[model samples]
Target: MHERIDEQITFRRLEVLLAFMEGGSLAKAAEMLDTSTVSVHRALHALEEGVRCKLFLHQGRQLIPTDAARTLAATAREVLSTLSSGIRTTREVAGYASSVLRLGSLYSLTLETVPAMIGELKAREMGLEVDLTLGSNTELLDRLSNGTLDAALLAVSELGAEFQTIELFEDEIFFAAPTGSKYAQHKTIDLQACSHEPFVSLHEGFATYHGFQRAFHLAGTTPTVAMTVGDVFSLTSLVSGGVGYTLLPGRIRGFLKDRVHFIPLDSRFQMKQQIGLTFLSIRERDPALLKLGVICRAMAKRFGIRT
Candidate 1:
């Protein structure tokens, strides 16, 4: 009987059982279901035989449900309710039930760029909802590749063949040190000047870390990295507290304005972070993404960033 149930029990059969339990008779269940009485009776019989138990008793033309049938019917109602709710939530997560734009960016951008972008997007499109994700550059790229993010704002030193990108701006890397430090007093300092200074830097996967490597390589010196951290904020705090000096983009200067000072790098060691908006090339025609691209370009131009 268990084997028969495993092979034959289906959602439709459960629904038929439920209708029969509620209506209490084959003819009444068929009337409520708008089906033939024969179909209802057959369904009930199949269900009982499959379970190897008498689910109903027949007296004259009336069908009364047994205790086991009542118990199964209650469980079936809960299962169907839960299944319906799961389907609804799945649709929402898949973006079928909402006007959500999944936007991704680096954690460093949240200090200014991300907030400004979100404000502009909301202003331009009424009723548009944004789902923002802030992560390391590597994490954002991975999410973008896997379709988890609809678009991303990130530093793009090297463009991937499968991505469609709009150049937003180029930010020059600067030497960030504690206020009143020797490097801070110089208008432009050569990277080699601080080659012996203790440095705090982001981890390897970060775009800024790559720029740091490029700076040292061009200067013909290696930095004495005293500590490594995960995010830009922590790196800034470490620099402000006099932990060590580090190289970072000028865009973040506003964040630790009072606690830290940024000086330009010499031409020989100059490195620029090419920041842009990126999305899969296959999503080029997405209307929301197109609108966002236009907004980002406008913001970049307003800030005197080369478009």
Candidate 2:
């Protein structure tokens, strides 16, 4: 009995009734809704049954509205209007169609990629503002999954189905040592030969950390990690002060210029990190994101991004 009552009072039926009341005829209502006249008439009849009220007078194919229908029409208009506004507000909170874009990125990108991307975005005159959050790839991915971030720039890896990704470039991991270190004199450093060397690393969950482990594992040796820090800046500082050697991406070379020496890894111990832009698949069509995609694609050309 409750199910039957619930089925009758639906938003679709209310919309039909409102359309008929406003358009004043079955033909006009059908035209307004882009439906057939039969559908419009059927909807109105069903709406009346659902409300358990006499909503019209039938006089030779004409539907004369009842006082009850007039009242119902006003209420229907209000209900639909409120629902429309609610949907817009909800989407705004979710970072779609909002004035601000909540963007997340790895701390390493702060040196070059992120700053350049944000500059181009602002210069486009799109009137969209960016709220930047920087952290490890794992932290950024977590924020994206929880709806706290609209999109993220991170290492491209096997991601869940909920994400849409655009690959920007591939960066090779290099051995980073303090200036004038004997390791820098080599054209390509061999990780196996340096197994006894002291190294500083970013903590777990960072892209660089993952690469660091992979390179050593391939070399069939484990590094002597003296310390693990949280951010790339600190990791670089530790390396610069000669605390320990570490593996870093080529992109951060500029940041550690003149302070650290970055040497390529031998082929047997080499690792490459693919950097990309990622967002929720559901928000791929958002206007702000579309604009952001345009800007990123233009930048990707510099790195010869794969299609």
Candidate 3:
């Protein structure tokens, strides 16, 4: 039963008519719209008044679309498509505009994990691009949270509720010094005994330094820090050039030369820290994120990530 032709059509009522026409039943349209069948029917009736025509000609219990109804349905499809395109464009600008994943990582991981992750991402997606940055855990996490970075491989496994993370790997710290330094000769070194040795270490807030703090706490002493630097490589340079002895992550092995020696720790704290990928919880909003997660985990496994 259709009525007057001049009344305005509400978008929802138009959408409902389009849904009913495409879907072929009021019940299915209601389910798709997340509404009750009665509500769908009510809107369809109102749509008849708005358009001043019969949209669906009912046969027994089946509702079939009229020619005019099908025409209107095409217009509705266009509207929905336009809306979707706009939202997708905005997200693409933030993440997908370039094929590259804008990635960040802790200074320590730049030695091994970042390179491996990039290699794996490229192998899995031939010609895949990656734009990478290196920073301390705090800087990388801040960039990740602020949308400047799409995702990060960070060694800071414990952050408050602000971040979402999944395990990438565990990086073990080791006692290291210049090749001929006094402690470098030991079969097993006790850190507490060397508490007076001048040390080079990451700045206090860094994950490596936090591991240092914990390990030294277990040893019941603190090393004398001769110089405080902010990165693993910087600490390595300072140590290798005979600046000071520092506790370094095993990843530093990749950068080692004849200038330094690495001795595995025999400590109560184990001197290990877990590293992982961190992002905003809504990473699901980007399908590419899932692909990145898969790539990150695969690379982590190759690096012998425990979890």
Candidate 4:
């Protein structure tokens, strides 16, 4: 009879083996798992040592499972599957949003994107528990890496290697003003032409603020930021009050459409903010996390937030 492995070989190590077998190479496995090939190899070595046998043999640049490896692989598949099912089901029994889904986003989405999404989730995930935190991408990333968030929606310049991402939607920063403003009835206004208008904008340290600045620089214009605020709703409110005209996502109208007016920035180059969901690839085992991602994708599409 085969001896049981010491320290139980860890569910993570078993997952590496399963991923390797399916991918047929350590590099591919690492790609799928969002880790380095070196890490995957070391995990497999430790797993094989734990089992006290060779689980795989290299064959002409390919990894092939041995007979024991085959048997153990099949067993591993079932063990992981059963364990996963138990954990997933247990989480459901506990509650949906049983824990907080730590979320972060650009300041622009706080008005409609965040509130609407959370409201919809509560309506559907009845009796589910959720702990919500609102912050910019940087603040949220710090929390997410520290395990404070299971998943978050954030603005990204580019994706990194530590997490998996699902595209939510692109928010084209529309030029906004009160109905009595000069551009109120214009079909579309040129972004560059607004260079002279006093504008309300997000404060620095927020991603959207930096993004908008970059876009303005690219357009070879320096905007006169009449006011620098923290939240998107505030920006819209200020605009409606005729404090100053500004650029915001079209979706923000979900809350204050009656008070604000939206006109597409018909610039030769319009700035767009990408909003999407992000989470550690390791947490994919949590069925609740996966389910929320699925729901969010559907939500984004339904609300026309998906590109």
Q: Residues 1-307, candidate 1, lDDT per residue (tens digit)?
A: 3433454566777889888877777777899889999999888788787777888888888888889999889988998888889977875675433578888988877877888888997887645588998877788889988889888889985666888888777888999999988777898988876798899999988899999998899888989999999989999999999999999898888887999999888888887888888888877866677777788889989877766
- For candidate 2, write residues 212-249 as lDDT tens digits: 99989999998999999999999999999999999999
Candidate 3 residue-wise lDDT, 1-307, digit = tens: 7664455576677788777876779899999899999999898887777777888787998877888888877877788778779978888877854477788888777766777777777778744577888888778877887788988887856677777776876767888889988877887668778888898879866888888888888889987888898778888999889988888888788786687888877756466777788888776556667777787667667767644
TM-score of each: 0.67, 0.88, 0.79, 0.63
Model 4 scores worst on lDDT over the 10 consecutive residues at 93-102
Alpha-carbon lDDT of model 1: 0.84
**Model 1 regions lying over 4 Å from their true place:** 1-98, 304-307
Candidate 4: clashing pairs of residues:
none
| Colliding pairs, model 3 | none
lDDT of 4 by residue, 1-307 (tens): 9865688489998899889888988999999999999999889888888888988787886668888877877888999999989987866554334555545565556666677777766777733355667777777777778777777777766657788777778777777889778898998877687788888887766666776787677778998888988777777889889888877766677757877888877766577777787887766666567666766777778857653
Off by over 4 Å in 3: 1-16, 27-60, 64-78, 96-98, 160-162, 303-307
Clash count in backbone of candidate 3: 0
After superposition, candidate 4 runs with Cα above 4 Å error: 1-100, 105-127, 300-307
- Estimate candidate 3's alpha-carbon lDDT, on a 0 to 1 scale: 0.78
Q: Is candidate 1 or candidate 3 better by TM-score?
A: 3
